[model samples]
Target: MNRSSARRPWHQHFETVGSITAIVVGVAALFVSFDQSRVMREEIRASIWPALQVDGFASLENGTLAIGLSVQNAGVGPALVERVTIRHDDSPVEDLDALRALMPPGADLSRTSLTGRVVAAGASVRPFELRYPAEESDDAIDVLNRLLSRWSAEVCYCSTLGQCWVASDDPGAPTMVDSCEGQPGGDF
Candidate 1:
């Protein structure tokens, strides 16, 4: 071939290489986005809900402490749980693994001691009855306030993906996003 014709083949080769490189980069970017989305969903699933309010602590009926509470479900979908977790002064009293294993899929309330109750789909306030030993003390208000004062009360819910965490400043208030810069242990 002549010199001009030989140069034409080099130009075509350059064009082909460029096209392949562009396609590979595009595909790699798409995969990266997909992977990042998956990670975010899992983080949300494990987010903990901060307890905002717990009402009616004046009376204890036969070791049964009835209190109304509100919880925020920050996950993408509804949070369903069979066994609720009842923390003693903010400490976990129930074994998370055992509770999860016994929980029937879609079961809202726990058959065992008062721990976690089912919060409705996308619900902000979930009302349920909680019972604790009467010997526990009528000082429930003091205990609750102490727990709330710390401003770290969290509720773990079973999501389709996994457990997610959420938090709020006031226990008597609904949970809200713990701004990234504000709270130290807020997000996943």
Candidate 2:
């Protein structure tokens, strides 16, 4: 065979290198795409995140004693309240009426349902309110303080995006949950 025929073609070497480089680039592109998708999903969740807080308010002002329990939405998105579990001294209270029975008589009490309610961002829903004359403030304050000490609440809410969380009167951050199904106690 001739000398030129004995040597391998240079273009064949280039072709091999080109094929390997193409595969590496393709794999790198796939990883980048996956990361971008993960980031996008996180952004979507954050955009509709909802935070709920169970708050108690009491004040002796304007010759009136005002005491209230409310659920506030502090997040940027609306909170869809799914379930509410209210307890007194660690026992479940069946409904609003039962809760009201635990309060002192002679005070005007008003309440709104928390379950199946929608709380908008930066808005609050007063689930329970008690008003008494300032002349009764001293007695009301003592009773109210005792009542509050024995009261606790747990709220399960979802974001507009369907992300679920559980917030309670306990001290801690809200916990993420798969769903807000089958909570104990009657709906309030």
Candidate 3:
């Protein structure tokens, strides 16, 4: 009932409640910020191509070396392969033929071109093929055989977002190894 004592209790209560509320808000904000940062990082990693697989071998027809690749999208978002770097037997080859002899005729690259979205998250196997204009000879066949037996192709893509993805398949596939995906890309 005394004025001083009554005011003291109210003041103490106010201070304790205010401090607790401030701490709770601060902790909540920190957790939210951390979660947002994690999500952003994950999104960046998903936008890039994660892996590549060789479905089969490339085919040799006329004077062209046809190759196949199975590109996969292992990101949280879609990806495309706009450019490619292929190698045969650990050596880089300029033309596709240097690695086509070992593949069957059906795996020709003449009609292979990545169009729509290939390889979605958890979706395996986006088959693709490649071709090069060059004659097939005995020596070339030997080279092709060796190359197809141990061939690999790296593919690059452009996304509307600001980033791209790359996927590769060792050896080859029945479809074009290079594909295109049109999706808004974001900076990683």
For this target, which candidate reaches the highest lDDT against the unseen true structure? 2
TM-score for each model: 0.36, 0.84, 0.44
lDDT of candidates 1 onward, in order: 0.44, 0.82, 0.52
Off by over 4 Å in 3: 1-16, 36-52, 58-67, 70-77, 95-147, 157-166, 170-188
lDDT of 2 by residue, 1-188 (tens): 77764586765567777998999999999999999999999998888788898866677877778777778888888999999888889999998778777776777887788889899999989887888777743655675667679888889999888889999877677899998997775557
Q: Give lDDT tens digits, candidate 1, residues 1-188.
A: 67875777544777788998999999999999999999987676545432323232323566654333445554445554323333433544344343333322332332222224455445565433234444565576764565454323344344444433343333443333322222222111
lDDT (Cα) of model 1: 0.44
Backbone clash total, candidate 1 = 20
lDDT of 1 at 182: 29
Question: Which of the two candidates, 1 or 2, achieves a greater TM-score against the reference?
Answer: 2
Residue 80 in candidate 2 has what lDDT? 94
Name the 10 consecutive residues with the lowest summed lDDT in model 2. 136-145
